[model samples]
Target: MRSLLYSSLLALCGALWARAFAQAAATQKRSVPPGFVTTNGRNFELDGKPFAFVGANAYWLPLLNTERDVDYTMQQIQASGAKVVRTWAFNAINETELPSATETGLTYYQVWNSSDWVVNDGPQGLQRLDYVVSSAEKHGLKLIVTFGNNWAAYGGIELYINWIYGAENATHDIFFTDPAIIASYQRYIKTIVERYKESSAVFAWELVNEARCTGDILSAGPNCVPGSNTLKTWYSQQSDFVRSLDANHMITAGGEGQFFSAHPAEYWFDGSLVSDYNFNGQAGEDFAGDLELPNLDFAGYHMYPQTWYPELDFPGSNFSVEEWGLGWISDHASAAAKANKPLIIEEFGVTGLQNKTDIYPSWVQHALDTGHARVMPWQFGVLGLTEDGGNRAIKYSDQIFRGASPNDGKTHSTLTRHKYGISSQRLRVFKANALDSH
Candidate 1:
């Protein structure tokens, strides 16, 4: 999801899988009222009140090039009225790693030499993350910090696999099976939870951005199977492991919300007469099953229509992309309701400001209407400098938006003009947070 649309719409999205705060050994702070956000079945409760919010995906917050960037980014998101922000808590650097353009700099939390890895909780490493948490607290916002990713974007699951087995030989799904790797992941999780366990600003801890039976550069090996059971067992173990560390905060499998149903038409929103692997247990995600994991507090799903299923976006399709997206949202909402767990539409967006303008309204409304969950668009972009140092985003997504067919490889200059303005930021941002239609 990071290549085309992301590059065009200003790339920064998050992933969350089923891992985190393990052991069930977690203890509440000595005498404090819960510094953690608690769940009320399908809804969230904060300070004894119902808590539902429009969050933002500022994945670059912890990995920003400088502290100034961190402070400024948080200010803008807080200004946007986004109650929560999602960022990567796991940043690892290796000679073979591939990260986003914004993920560069010395802001990593871990490092791998040729032999083993070192967790950096020093000033240059996780202290940046601590600042991110502290800044959100200062801004009166909460945070969802994801520990790892399935994609090889930052230091993902593959990164750990790379350290265990060579890149060419590494299998993605081994992360769930390897004892050494599991212990390593849990060690880092322990460090993070212990650090933020008492901070109310931490909304949740995501095990990985998006977990699956596959990896980016290297796919899964023989041991890894593309069914719910294999993934379910690993997720079960990880969630329980997380419960052992800190029992106060919430946890979720930051996932793409793929289902395990072999029958396509069985799901009301599937719109399929035949079984598609994405829906029929082959793609290693089972939304409802993930929710049932004991220590998991909620469920998550990412929506990307043009990327995952381009046929529907093509001509002569049964419906428009927005319509398909609406179905996807409804499907997940029903799943979350059935599981009686709060859901988060953590990552979703369409390119072309015009498309977003015409599309997001119904999708966002449908999401809010269907359940007690949060709708966080893929990102919150800044008026960044173009390669030539000019200041026009041509067309950006997030709250401030514009246009282009990233699908068709259209240039920024090729897009039809949409008057760019500063007012669009605050106005559209509030639109995202509030239920107001733009």
Candidate 2:
């Protein structure tokens, strides 16, 4: 009898311990903070505190770099007084369908097909992005997670277009019109939003990076521009879809500050000269109308005056670089003000190759003075030159890193490196212009 009683007690204790352990695990899964970043009138609020940020682009943070590199880079970013970072959350691979030369043959392109997205437990897949979210939280930084790309760099819209309609018939515009492609994209978005819904580290979701239609594979050229109505409809649908999944985060169109006019024939070249790439001209994006979406949380634009307006004889050339940049800011600010929404210059940079360092501080100061919520330069990384050359390259050791061949591109000059990285001069400008405009 005594032996039996002891055995029963042991069994009961084990059962209780197991139950407690399971409950603990469940609670841990739901432990993410409930509070999230939000917008009020025209300002952003985090945990009930007004938030303004000076940030940088680390587009490859979650996809290309290592844990150590992410850690080091985040530390440096936080140290530089940058409160937020923007990085890609989506990278497609092998999702595109290709047609073979033979009538009965079909081939699939696996690279850049992000549709096979899985949040598995490993260094690859969404595990790397999971690390980024957790690390950004640990180091006190907010993230702007862009969902798709307009360009072909990362199997962007082109991959989806090709996947739905074979590569032979693929066009960038189909990404907006095709029902099957839209469904596939929504599925991918659902997976991502469901996975990250509980985390507060994400500040906003960008529908696409510079969402524009430059034509299909065969007819590819600057002359091809998708209709503004098509682009806006797609933006509305996607923003609504994201809102359906995650209600806490904000949404942005990710346009390049292209103003739209109905009377393109009459008012085309009056304010700014039309160019294949110029947003004010034939570029398909309608910045103001896009921001007017009921679901879009804020207005955002990218400024590259040096590249966008390189010709001296351009209509706006009468203004200095600083004036041109400020004018761009003013135009966007006016639109945002009219809409009663906050504005962010999500991407802007002056290439050192252009010898335009003087334009940097001026732009920063003007942006702050104009009440822009955030100004994130093109990028921040471990590879660029620092003030004393103390920072070293953070080795990207993952297979994807090796496969992508990030280093295969042309090397930037030391001066360009200084401009891109958190050099002392740039840091000083960023820090000094960073104002708490609550």
Candidate 3:
């Protein structure tokens, strides 16, 4: 009888021990946070976990794009393991892209005519913003939207370019420092925040789109004018304005190229901001200078091998894919490691290469492995579809960026999960058979 009792007691202890072990494993898993930023182990996370982005860009307007090409694009984007899409909030020209205040029968702003910003309260202009927010929620994607640019008519870069070059060839200025403009911007921010305070689809708010030639913008040159300081002040004010209105989302300037260093990130933006750079790592066009950039969250690089190194013959020009991808990855990685920030390839896509479709996955993988940057291809749609379709990043090339080679009038969608190291579970697959169960 004593022997029987001993055996029973031993079984009970073993059972308890197993239960405790299982509980401990559960606790450990719970300790790690999810998403892009985390609290332990790797020191950061994406989508609340140790994450990586395997996706493309969603340019222009989120509301209109999603309804039109986004549905198809999302399938490709999701299949590629992308959880975020980047776009611009307003076009520069104010053509008619701004949506109604309560448009789309939702809480977000949809795209109206690109000219809506120039004329206030026109028949179609006077509407409230709601559709944009709603459309994003419906689309199952997060938006990284920029507020300012020099495109169309809202002129930021165009004016600067003109100042740098000449007035005849320059674009007009959509100075941000104008008081009425500031007020109007504030109104837009307030409406967006109020409408989507509870929404989770927003990734981050970008302040401006690539402020090139700060010298020209600040100069007394013909197109230069005298508003560089005003523009700078306006840029700072609008950033603060957005932060004041809503503290829930992340904020960064949609700054292009040297603008990241044009204004130091520490002084201009809060510590949690993300700034961008183009092909080179050094300040200005000097690619061989020191690459350290202080206080940036993510290093951004737009890998256009054909642009700077035009001698090669690939898409933009002509270069071997291996050389181009390696060079870009090397530069991005060097900068990112210096900044101690996660890197993001803010934009990149095959423009006019013979084998663009086949080469995309290889380059993307190179970016993931070497650059260690989250990437967003360009443009979902811009022409007329409520979805993605344009020469921006994800579509065919245009006159400005068509490079030497051009598309052969073929539209194909052949996205595979393995290329991006992703699976249906949205986890990276390192090897064909080795799957991450978690």
Clashing pairs in 2: 92-112, 92-113, 92-114, 93-110, 93-112, 93-113, 93-114, 94-109, 94-110, 94-111
**How many backbone clashes are present in model 3?**
62
Q: Report residue 411 deviation for candidate 3 (angstroms).
A: 8.7
Whole-model lDDT per candidate? 0.65, 0.61, 0.40
- Give a tens-digit lDDT track for model 2, residues 45-104: 666555666666777676433566567667766765667788887765552322221121
**Overall local distance difference test of candidate 1:** 0.65
Which candidate should be chosen as best, given lDDT against the real structure? 1
TM-score of each: 0.78, 0.72, 0.54
Alpha-carbon RMSD, each predicted model: 8.6, 15.4, 14.5
Give the 10-residue window scoring lowest on summed lDDT in candidate 3.
Answer: 1-10
Residue by residue across 218-269, what tens digits does model 3's lDDT show? 4322333222333344445666777677655555545433322334322112
Tens-place lDDT digits, model 1, residues 204-321: 8888887888877777667665453767777788788887887778888887888886564332234655456567766677777777887788888898887866655667756578
Question: Cα miss at 435, model 3 (Å)?
Answer: 13
Q: Give candidate 1 regions above 4 Å deviation.
A: 1-35, 95-104, 167-169, 226-228, 265-274, 384-438
lDDT for 95 in candidate 3 is 26
**Model 3: per-residue Cα lDDT at residue 32:** 20
Candidate 1 vs candidate 2, TM-score winner:
1
